[model samples]
Target: MAHSHDSTALDLPLPARRHQTLALVLVRRLAGHGLHDARATMLALDAGGTEFRRLLVLARALVVDLARTSRRRILLAPCCAAGMTRDEGLLMAMIGGGGLDVHGVLTDDAGCAIAMTTAHALGDELERLATRNDWRR
Candidate 1:
């Protein structure tokens, strides 16, 4: 006798699936909020324009709860007056001395590196939080 084989699979864990669904919902909400498309948003941000700055600000704001829960420290660099810098400054200030550190730099390149470093540090904290079962499900 011959047997037929099927190769389709869905391998996500329950909590992970729920988290992914929540993320998708958030993405849809972002798109509805004038982010256009996710790919377009990524391109725009990579291109570094006013829209990019706005999108970054929105993205950062959306992740504030996660940052707080993770006890992440963010160092913000000031580059423009178009609101992103202002908003990040406000966020860092709100986090106070222990939680986040805000630094203003002269060039966009320096600012980008600082932001990247902050993100890296935050990622480590988030990982630790996850390992310790401190992350919200």
Candidate 2:
């Protein structure tokens, strides 16, 4: 069976052609890897539309940093493309839930170093949470 619409409208919450276009772009990019594999990655992320926007923005920002390869290697970086890891998202969720002033930057070799003063017990809790959550700290 075939379906037709009188008007060119999609019943998506995104409500903008740009949104659909970007999604299609990402899908096509992922398709280069393999449709099934790409879909699995997308589904595994369980990402929302806003996250897609974030990825597009980051990809555009780092275009200079990324090589001009046909594979679009910039999209492969989970940190920029996917924004935050699961535990990072969870930590943000917790921070947003409360008024915690946990500000820090992640270093490749050196590990997380908070600038603010943290109590020993709280630091231990944060460390435990980081390990348990499997964050990239």
Highest-TM-score candidate: 1
Model 2 residue 8 distance off true place after TM-score fit, in angstroms = 48
Task: Give TM-scores for every candidate, taking all chains together and pairing residue i with residue i.
Answer: 0.22, 0.18
Candidate with best lDDT: 1
**28-113, model 2: which lDDT tens digit per residue?**
34433443344534532333332333343332322222122212121222221423233232223222222232222111111222
Q: Model 1: residues >4 Å from true position, as ranges? A: 1-111, 134-137
lDDT of each: 0.34, 0.29
Tens-digit lDDT track for model 1 on 37-59? 46536643543344345434444
Model 1 poorest ten-residue lDDT run: 2-11
RMSD of each: 18.4, 19.0
* Candidate 2 displacement at residue 13 in angstroms: 38
Question: What are the clashing pairs of model 1?
Answer: none
